[model samples]
Target: MTLDLPLIWAGLIAFAVLAYVVLDGFDLGVGILFPLIRGEPHRDEAMNSVAPVWDGNETWLVLGGGGLLAVFPLAYAIIMSALYVPIIVMLLALVFRGVAFEFRWKTQRGKFLWDWSFAAGSTLAAFAQGVALGALVQGIPVANRAYAGGWWDWLTPFSILTGFALVIGYALLGATWLIWKTEGHVQRRAYDIAFWVAPATLLLIGVVSLWTPFLSGPYMARWFAWPQVLLVAVVPLAVLGAGFLLIRGLTERREIAPFLASLLLFVLCFIGLGISFFPHLVPNSVTIWEAAAPDNSLSFLLVGGVVLIPIILAYTAYAYWVFRGKVNAAGGYH
Candidate 1:
C-alpha cells in the first residue's frame, strides 16, 4: 500500500507524544508525589529512581516539539501562538523543576523550598499541558489559521478539567514508576497511591468523555459513529482491564506487575485520544495535511530520525539495564 504522507506524519506525531507521556510522565508524577514522601531518605530514593532516565526521557519531548516546528510549521505556529502563555508557563515550570532536582541535592539548608518548587513546578507543567490539550480538542478560536480570540480564549471549563485530569494521570504514572524502582516503605506507599489514584484517573476520563460532546459538536459524531465507536470503546475497556490487573498485582504484592499494568493503561488512554483527534492537528482549525511542511522537510526529518531514534532507544535501554536493581537510600545519583 502507498504511504499517505499526512497519515505518516500524524503517526510520527502520535509516537512522539506517547513516548513523552510514557517516559516523562513518570518523572512528572514523581514530582507531584514529592510532597507526600516523608523525610530526606525517601525523597532521595524517589529522585534516584528516575535520575539516569529522566533527562533522557525529556529528549522525546524536544524531538516532538522540534519535529513539529520543522515538519508542521503551520500547526506549530498556530498552536504556539494560541497557547503562548500556557507553553511559557510549562517551560518555566519544567526549568524550575529541573533546577530544583539538581540544587536540592547540593543545598542542605533550603531543601524544603526546593522540594516544594519541584512539586509545584511539576504540577504546573502537567496542568498546562492538559489545558493546551483541552483547548486543542475543544477547537481554538481560529479563523484563517490564526487565533481570532483574546488571550484567555484557551481557558475554558473543558481546559481546566483536563488540566486536573492530567495531574491525576501523571501521578498515576509516577506511582507506577515508584513501584518499579523503590522497595520497602517507599514501594508500599507508592502502591497505595496507585490503588487510590487509578480510580480517580478513570473518573477523569469519564468526565472528559461526558464533557467533550457538549463542548465540541463533532466529538459525539466522531466517537459514536458506527465502526469508530467500537474502536473507541476498546480503549476504555483495555484501560479497565489494566486497572483490574494493577489492583490485583498491588493486592498480591506482585512488585513490578502493577507498574507494568499502569503503563499499559496509560498507553491505551493515549491511543484513545489519538484516535479521537485523528486528522486534526490544531483541532478544527487545521488538518494534518494542511499544517504539514513540504515533503522535502519531512524527508529531512525522517533521515534524522533514522540516526537519532535508535541511539535514544539504545541509551535508554542501557540505563535501565544498569539500574535494574531496586532503589534504596544509598542509591546515590551519580
Candidate 2:
C-alpha cells in the first residue's frame, strides 16, 4: 500500500500548529493581562494560575516547528527563512517572559520591572505571531524553493492591523480565563474587561474575515463559489454566535462558559482559515505535495510523530487535569 505520506504529514503538522496556537494562546493572554490587575496579590494569583502549565503549553510550538522541518523541508526552509526576524523577536520576548516568571519572586527590588517585562514580552510575542500570520496570508514571494521577497515585505499596514487585532483577541482570552480561574475582585474585574474587549475582538474578527477574502484570488474564488459559498458562510455565522455567547457569558458572570465561548471563536476562525487555504501551506505558494520531503524521510518521521504526539497530548491533558481548580492567592504555585 502506497500511503500518501505527504497528506498524513500535512495533517500532523496542522494539528500541532493548531494545538500550539490554542494551548499557549490563553497563557500568553494571561501575560498580556498582567498590567491590568490592581494589587500585588491579584497579580500573583494570575501568574500562579498559569505557572504550572505555561512551560508545557509552549512545547506545542516546538512540536509544530519540528514536525514541519521533518515532513516538509522545502516549506520549512522557505517559510522560516522568510520569517526569520519576527521569529527571533518572538523567541526573545518569550524567553524574557519566562525568565521574568522565575526571577520576579526571587527579588523584591526589581519586581515591578519584571512585571513590565512579562507584559511587554507577552504582547510583543502575540503581536509578532499575528504579523507573521498576516504576512503569510498576504502571500510571500517565493521562487525556486526560496524567498524572493525582502525582509520588509512582512511589515505592512494589513500586518499591523492583524497584530493589534490579535492583541485584543488574546486579551479577551486572558480576561475570560481569569474569570474561570479566580474569584472576588479579580474575577469581577475580568468580567468588566471582557465586556469591553469582547466587542472589539468581534469587530476585528469581522474586519479580518472581510479583508482576508480580498487578499488572495484563490480564496476569493473558493469563498464566493456557488454551492460551496453557502457552506463556507456557516463559519462566520458560527463565529458570530460564539462571540455572542462569550458576551452573554461575561454579562451573566458565568465562570467557564465565557472561556469556552471565546475558544470556540478561535476554533471556528482556524477552521475558516484552513478552508480558505486548503492544500497550500504557504497560501498560493508552495503546496503540501510539492514542498514535502522525500517519502522515505516522511515515513521515518511519521513513525516517530505518531508515537510522540499522543504522548504530548496525554501529558498536556494530565497536567491540566492535575492542576484544575480556582487559583488561591494565599496558596499559589510559589
Candidate 3:
C-alpha cells in the first residue's frame, strides 16, 4: 500500500500548531493579564509561573512553521504573501515579549516599562495570530498559484472580531493558569478575573463559531449536512461540557480543574476548525496533496520528525514534571 505522505505530513503539521497554541498560550495569557495583576510581586508570581516552560513551549511554533515551509511550500508562499503584515507584527511582538521576559529581571529602574512591554507584546502577538487565522479561514485570494489579494485584505471586521476573541481567550487561559500555579493574592485575583473572563471567552467563541459557517459554503455544508452533522454534533456538546466544568471549577474554588477545562475548550475549538479546513490546505483553493512536497522529500523529513518529535516530547514532559507544583511566592526557578 502506498503511504499517504501528504496526509501524514498535514496531520503532523496540524498537531504541531495545536501544541503551540495549547502550550505557549498560557504564558502569553500571563502577559495579557499583566495590567490586571497589580503590584510587582503579583506580576513576578505570574511570570515565575511560566518562567521555566515559556521558552520551551515555543518550539512547537518553530516546528509548525518550518514543517509548513518544507512540506507545503506553495501554501506557505501564498499564506505569507497574504498575511505578511500580521505575521511580521506577530514576530516583532514576540521578540519584544521575549526581551522583556529576561530584561525585566535585570533592571530595577526600568522594570515598569518592561512590564508594559510584555503586556503590549503579548496582546499584539495574540491579536495578530487571531487575525491571520481569521484571514486564512475566510480564504486567501489565490490566482494562478499565487496570492492575489490586496495588502489590507486581512484587516476585515471578522478578522478583528477573532483578534478580540483571541485576546479574551488568552486572558482566560492566563487567569486559569494562575489559579493552578499560584496562591494568596495572585490566585484570588486570578479566580476573580477568571470568573468574568471565562464567560466572555465563551461568548466570543460562540460569535466566531457562528460567523465561521457563513464565510464559506463548504463550511456551512460540512457543519450542517446529515452524517457530518452527526459527527460534528459532538463538538458543541463537548464545548458545553467544558464550559460547565470551567464555571463550576472557578465557582467552587477548584484550582486545576478550571485550567484543564479551559484547555479542553480550546482543543474542541481547534478540532472544529480542523473539520472546517481539512482536505484543503488553502481552503477552497488547494488540496493537501496539491501543496505537499514530493514523497521522497516527505519520507526523508518524516524519519527525522519521528526521532525529533519524541525527544521533544520527552524533554517537555520532563521539564513540566520537574517544575510541577505551585510557583514559590518568594523565589522562583533561576
lDDT string, candidate 1, 208-241, tens digits: 8777766665677777888878867887788788
Compose the digit string of candidate 2's lDDT tens values, residues 1-334: 8899999888888888888887888888989989988788989888888888999998989988888887888888888888888888889999999999898898888999999999999999999999888888888889877889997888888888888998888998899988998888888888888898899999999999899989988999889989899999999889979988988887788999999998898889889889988888878998989999888898888888889989998999999888888987764521
Question: What would the TM-score be for candidate 1 when compared with the true structure?
Answer: 0.95
lDDT of 3 by residue, 1-334 (tens): 9999999999999999999998898899999999998998888888999998999999999999999999999999999999999999999999999999999999999999999999999999999999999999999989999999999999999999998888889899999999999998999999999989999999999999999999999999999998879989999899999999999999999999999999999999999999999889998899899999899999999999999999999999999999988886565633
- In terms of lDDT, which candidate is stronger, 1 or 2? 2
TM-score winner? 3
Residue pairs with colliding backbones in model 2 are: none
Clashes of 1: 0
lDDT of 2 at 36: 89
**Candidates sorted on TM-score, descending:** 3, 2, 1
TM-score of 3: 0.98
How much lDDT does candidate 1 score? 0.84
Q: Against the true structure, candidate 3 has what lDDT? A: 0.94
